[model samples]
Target: MPAPLIWLGAACLGLYASNKANVAYLKHHDIVDAMPGESDQKSIPVNGSIVTCGIYGVLDHTGIWYENTIYELSGKGLVRCVSPERFLGNRSGTHIYVACKPNNKVLANCLAANRARKQLFTLLDYHLFDQNCHRFVAEMLVNHEVAVTSFSDLNTFLSEFFDVPIKWNRALVKK
Candidate 1:
C-alpha cells in the first residue's frame, strides 16, 4: 500500500472523530435542537417568545413572536411582522417552534416583543452567517449587539439570558 494512502485514511478517521466530538459537545451544552417536523399538534406561542421554523430541514429561521404575529428579519434585511401562515409559507416545514422552559412553560419577556414592534419596517444589512435572523432575534431580546450565528448559539444565549435550559415547543397557527 502507498504511504500517501495510509496518511489519507488517517486524516479521514481524524475528521470523523472530530465530528463526533463536536456533536457530543453540543448535546452536553443542552443546545436546543430546532429541527422541524418534530411535532404534529399545533400550539399557541406566548408574546415575546423566541420562535423558529426549519428551513430546508437543515437551517432554522428565527423571529420574535409579538401579539398574534411574528416579527422577523426578511432575507432582504427588512424587519417586518407576519402571520404564522405567512411565516411558514415557502419554507420546507410548517411547524414553528417557540422557546420555552424545560417544564414546557413558555419563556418570554414582554420587553422583547415591544422592542421588535418598535423596529418594524427597519432595514438592516443582512448577512447569511453573520447578521441574520438569529442575530435579529437576539437583539430584540437583549436590546444590544449579540453575535449569534446559529440556532444552537441563540439557544445557548437564551438559556443564559433566562437562566434555564431552553426547550422548543411547536406553535399553533390560529385561524
Candidate 2:
C-alpha cells in the first residue's frame, strides 16, 4: 500500500501492454519481412552500374545490420557503393544502422532501447564504462537483427528486454 508499490504496479501494467503491442505490430505488417520466405515483403533492383536491393518506403524495419554497402545516385544515374555503417545515421550524418531477421524481431522493443542508449553514450562521447562496453550492446543489437531508432532510449529498452540486470557495468548504462 506504499507509494513505491503503487508506482511499481502501474509500471508493470504499462509494460505488459507495451510488450503486447510490440508483438502485435511485428505480426501486423511483418517487421522482419526482409527475410527470405513466404511472408517476405518486396525488393526492387535499381538499374545502375550494378545490381542493388532497395527496401521501398519509410520502412520502419530498423536494426543492427552489418556494414553492407551505401549507394549514391547522381543525376546522371551513376551509382556508387560505399560502407553503410561509416556513412549512415543518414540525414543526421551519424545515425547508426541496423538489420533484423525473423528472430531479430525478438528485439522489437527491448534491445532497440538498449542499442539506442549505447548510441547516446557514444554521441555524448562519455567513457562512463569500458571501451569494450559498447561491444556488449553491439552484440545485442547485432543479435542476428535489431531495430533501434536513436541513441537516447537505452534505459527503456533495458526494462523491456530483460527482467533483470546480470551485468556489473549495466547499472551505469542507466540514467
lDDT of each: 0.80, 0.30
Quick one: RMSD of model 1? 6.1
Q: Say which candidate scores most in lDDT.
A: 1
Cα error, candidate 2, residue 38 (Å): 18
lDDT of 2 by residue, 110-141 (tens): 44344433443232222322212222343343
TM-score, one value per model: 0.81, 0.26
Q: After superposition, how far is residue 61 of candidate 1 from its true place, in Å?
A: 0.3
| Top TM-score prediction, candidate number | 1
Cα displacement (Å) at residue 30, model 1:
3.0
Cα error, candidate 1, residue 160 (Å):
0.7
